[model samples]
Target: LKAGVVEALKTVQYMGIPQMVVTSTRTEVALLKLARFNILSYFEDVLGGDQVSKGKPHPEPYITGANRLKVPTKNALVIEDSENGVKSGVAAGCMVLHMPDLINTKLEWNNVIYGALDSLESFPEWLSSKQFGMWV
Candidate 1:
């Protein structure tokens, strides 16, 4: 697993920040992966590729996620690790934070992204910074 995923989830849980998985992976497969990693309980919901007509870069997934959480897209904060995910979140009107996974983030995205995270491990600090005025 990537570093600090458990800690990040715990931090968010402690802060009462709701989260959901909006992944291109299938729901069943994603659920199994989350279960295998023992992080299934951290998410409020999971929107899989199979569950949505459109996937990343289409905004449908992120839009559906925010709708499921009963929050407006403008109020949602999307932490993405891929270019397409970032594009989708931006297209959905949510604040997007790029945490590069295998691919290096595009420099041009700096103009559009709300913020950038070095890794998921840094989520606590990022949230605590209050740049976007997080409740916690």
Candidate 2:
């Protein structure tokens, strides 16, 4: 998970975009240890589950992240790997891109969620594609 997160951070860095990882993990000690291994400075902030009033499936977490970044929820783009994450983004009015997970997710929200992407490696490309517009 640490390596994957580092790679994901690198990818975002390559795109010259700022990011903040909002996690539902109980403890972020692993993140602190892993940060030394691959400190991709792109991640502006790293938030834990305890930081917000609610976890996934609620807007609070995502809203907290957007608020911390000083970016409105409407302009935020969330890349989540679980059904609950997807729901949280939708509830927050952010554009969500879901990475496939074991739990099947119903992405019923219109432009709130562009699509469920396949892999992290393909994420930047798919997100950059001119064919897909931002959430309205």
Candidate 3:
């Protein structure tokens, strides 16, 4: 996890929001990493590629996350760092906020992206801003 991710997650939890981890990594590896970071409790569920029939760029992973969270796909918000992840979220009918960790330019899939942020630290403030209302 990033420096402010835990704080952001805590804020979300405080606000009574439900969160789930949907990653392309294997289930055991993802759980191990989250446990190692001591952030496993922050998520209501942790889903991995192995849990789904298909991986990123396919909607299965994110759809499974929404199902596990008991939230409608349209009501879910996906924070993604990669094109494949963004695509998966979009395809699953979830709002995707792209904060690319590697790429510097806009992706060709920008049309589906709900918003773009410079860093994870901005996520909490962004969630509280009027822009979030407009987007949602």
Candidate 4:
């Protein structure tokens, strides 16, 4: 777990985006073990599920993330690969990008999704075009 977290931190750092690991109460202890591996400092904030009133698919987690970043919900971009995660991000009024990775499939899309990208590698071009207000 620690090695995985360390690799994840390195990846996120390579992308130049601030990253944090949000865990639920049942998994906080696991995070502690992960911290022992010295990867905790890579995250700006580490929140436990008990800290929020709701859980996944409820918007609270992502909402809390947006709050921590001091960014408006609408301006926040959520990259979720699960149906529940997509729903939660939408409920929080965030601009969500649905990536159907190994954990997700075509059946998950129900029309409410803003956009779907083929894979992570496609994000940079898509984001740039969207930022320029060109929906090509």
Candidate 5:
């Protein structure tokens, strides 16, 4: 996790917004990471690779997250770092915010991405902005 991510999670939690972690990693590994970062309690649910039949670039993982959260897929916001994760989120009907990490290439499926963010530190401010209101 980034420096401000925990603080952002705190703000989100304080606002009573529901959050879920949908990852390609195994459940145990995901949980370990969350625990290591002391962010395990922020998420309402964590759906990992083993929990889904298909992985990234397929809709199954993100769809399962939305279903587990009991919200419509269209209402979900997925923050992803990879192209396949972005595809999964888009395929599941969720708005995806891409914060590119190791991958530096331009996204070919530009239409599918909601927006590309500069950093995770901007997430909280972005969420409070009018543009984010339009998204919700």
Candidate 6:
């Protein structure tokens, strides 16, 4: 997890927003990562590679994520840190917020991404404020 992500997750949870993790990694690995941060309880579920027939950039992971949450892809918000993740979310018809952690984007992502954040800590504010209808 990135810095302040635990707090962000807790804050979103406190606000009663449903959250789920969509990752290309295997389900067990993703779960272990969340467990390492002690944030497993914050998400409803993790839609991982084990659960998807395809990986990031294919939209299957994100589609599965929305399905697991019982929400439409258009209504889902994806906070991503990688290029493939962003592409996957966009292809899935979800709003993607990019926050660079390990990968620094180079291509023209603004046209595809819903928003860019300096840090994951700001996601809750963006969700709470007048961001894309302010989560109405």
Q: Give a tens-digit lDDT track for model 4, residues 11-63.
A: 55655566655455544774786578777777777666777889778989878
Q: Tens digit of lDDT per residue, candidate 1, span 22-97?
A: 9999999999999999999999999899999989999999999999999889889898988899999999999898
Lowest-lDDT window of 10 residues in candidate 1? 127-136
lDDT of 6 at 22: 84
TM-score: model 2 vs. ground truth: 0.77
Q: What is the C-alpha lDDT profile of model 2 across 1-136, one tens digit per residue? A: 5225556666667665568878787437637744666663567887788777789888998999898888889878898878788889889988787776655546464455867766676765665563333422
By summed lDDT, the worst window of 10 consecutive residues in model 6 runs over 127-136
TM-score attained by model 1: 0.94
| Cα TM-score per model | 0.94, 0.77, 0.90, 0.62, 0.90, 0.90
What lDDT tens digits, residue by residue, belong to model 6 across residues 20-135?
A: 98878888999998998788999998877878788989998888888878888887888888888889999999988888885875469878778888897787686667444444
Give lDDT per model, in order: 0.88, 0.72, 0.84, 0.67, 0.83, 0.82
lDDT of 2: 0.72
Best candidate according to TM-score: 1
Candidate ranking under lDDT, highest first, comes to 1, 3, 5, 6, 2, 4
Model 5 TM: 0.90
Clashes of each: 0, 0, 0, 0, 0, 0
Candidate 3: regions farther than 4 A off: 105-107, 130-136
Q: Tens digits of per-residue lDDT for model 3 on 6-70?
A: 87898778767888999999989999999998999988999988889999999999999998888
Residue pairs clashing, model 5 = none
Error of 3 at 104 (Å): 3.2
Residue 14, candidate 2: C-alpha displacement in angstroms: 3.2
Question: By how many angstroms RMSD does model 2 differ from the true structure?
Answer: 3.4
Error in Å for residue 86 of model 5:
0.5
